[model samples]
Target: MTDQTDGGRRLSTQEAARVLGVKPATVYAYVSRGQLTSRRDPAGRGSSFDAAEVADLARRSRREAAAPAGGELSVRTALTLIEPDRYYLRGVDAVALASRYRYEEVAEWLWTGKLAPGAVFTAPPEALAAAGRAVAALPEHSGPIDRLRVAVAAAAVADPLRFDLSEEAVLGSARCLIPTLVGALPEKAAPSWPGDGRISRRLWSRLTAREPDPDALAVLDLALSLLVDHDLAASTLAVRVAASARAHPYAAVSAGLGALEGPLHGAAGRLAHRMLREVLEQGSAAPVVAEYLRAGRRVPGLGHRLYRAEDPRATALFARLEELPHAAPALTAAREVATTMARQRDLHPNVDLALAVLTVSSDMPPESGETIFAISRTAGWIAHALEEYQAPPLRMRPTGHYEGPTPPQPLP
Candidate 1:
């Protein structure tokens, strides 16, 4: 039940309790509140998630993932989303919001749970340093998301206050790490957080040296808002598991960060990027898609686990990109490729694919896109962590097989 969860370590309910310094029953509360994620094993029993992501969530929320409550603690849950579910930001669908608002405004809506009618951004020391580290650590050939994975992992290690889960530090990491990572990914020199203003409280603020074009910023904000939450992403589940253990926010956030490093979570963006590139190069989506179907592999960046409507974020970005002046040939080419999918195929654009083109067009640094996502997503993770912190820990236990005990009674 140790707190650290790296390289895909999953924890059960009882195990989670040991890490959080609480009983297993409290962990159950976390599950009921949508703070934790789990899966159904073959036996129809649900298994809890890894604790690392929960700890990571704690770090950004300015609170522990799970704290004392009525003499009980949260517990791990065993549930699954057979399909992806629709996500929202500030009560708006991602696509509609992106189309109508600026990135700054959108971020505010997500963080505050209100559509604050103003710009949104953040620029904290941690955000700045972490963003740079993400880009610097990338292999020369890596894409935005891959670099982000490495950067996030490294940032967790580099934080001077890695174990401090105070409100100041957690909020500080949310503001600083996000913007800095966005700025540094483009191979730029070190970035300094803006001294004052609302932007100072934002993760996206410092990522751009100049004032963001209102339109582009709006789109990004919308995208960020949309991506701010999901039912129980693998990494997010990790966040709740840590809360079940009563790990501090930073520790839970570290766990979440580790989960994001896995291919299933953080790497989805890279898949979208690669798929778009392939489609553009082929100059025909049909053959490219056909090939995948032949191999019986599902297409990336096409259908989603949730959302009967095309991903609103994707639609907004694609529509907006279409409107941009003299959009680059690569972007135009990518859109042509995306359109080839059937509308009824229920195939739609997702945030990842749209971001691939948007980041390139923004001329942001190589890994800036993925780094930004980590920064942006921290907000949602933090929110979930805070919710977890209010609950008590839970306990979990299961029977162990003893078939061989009698036969192996001889002492060594």
Candidate 2:
């Protein structure tokens, strides 16, 4: 039933659920997540939602459901599913999984479907040495992604079983290659431990020279677990395409890295970092945001395609950042940016903004978030590659729709 109120027409909980095409429990979940607003009925009947709001939410749901138009390639996998304001990995709540388990443990579960406590990925000495040499060969000015590309190539050459497509062989290679990639990065700080530690611990030294507090280190680890996989993202699709062509796991990861280089795919964190730094320097987000609009640039880190509300990853990371004393200023700046933009449009903060807060507060460089994303997402890429390996080879080819002048009149 709909009731007319001062704000507008309002729908009861059941009506809202029907409009959203979800169960009543899901509607309540949305309300709890701040994805939907609920008001108590004046008659004390039940909770009510704004009719316009429910209609808008229903439209977004429909658009998301029909995103893949005709002829669009869709691959089936038991990996990840992104919904209105939440995502799941292998049927587990990703945020809960990330918060409860270490990054390595979550990654192991994603790869093999079973949790192994205290899971550790150790790189083979030869592969590590090879990757280090290749990374060193790059020009000093090369970015982290460039160095990672070189490292993966060198590691692949060092593995004698690189061509093996067997699940066992691929899994073994993934475990070693991830650690090798992390180990190959040039360390910015002196070693706290003698070369053996979690991937997050080793990566910390490379990202910043500051000694990590337990809370900060925990946040980094949480970030890694949350980012391990995210459906078939653009880079993941690139990885799948390579795997479909029988590319080895290392080569498939390299393809993902190549795709990640695009500005739209992986560079948002750096841009967000710069924006937050400017907000800190200028003491307000209003002028900074105005300048961005004046220059005809879309504000970065404000929205996500997959999420209409707050990004679940951003929500999780922001909650953790709140507990860190050092992160206060950057976190405030992030919120200010979001609030300032919200006055004009109702965009929410995405993971890039949260990552920028972590990097900016931790004294890490702007590109550090991209590096973290690449490293963490390698597990996901490998997992997708594993799935692709089990399917028929060359199944990803799609017929091109050619639209041009008639072919017979090409006598130029």
Residue 273 in model 1: lDDT = 62
lDDT for 263 in candidate 2 is 94
- Residue ranges of candidate 1 with Cα displaced over 4 Å: 1-86, 90-169, 183-214, 328-346, 360-369, 394-412
Give per-model CA RMSD. Answer: 13.0, 15.0
Per-prediction TM-score: 0.60, 0.83
Which residue segments of model 2 deviate by more than 4 Å? Answer: 1-69, 194-196
* Weakest lDDT window of 10 consecutive positions for candidate 2: 60-69
Error of 2 at 314 (Å): 0.4
Q: RMSD (Cα, Å) of candidate 1?
A: 13.0
Report how far residue 371 has shifted in candidate 1, in Å. 3.1
Candidate 2 residue-wise lDDT, 21-122, digit = tens: 655776886788787999987779989999999899777655543453574777768899899889998999999999999888998889988999998999
Clashes of each: 69, 0
- Candidate 1 lDDT by residue in tens digits, 298-370: 6666656567756655676677676555346547655665676664365766667677776556654434555
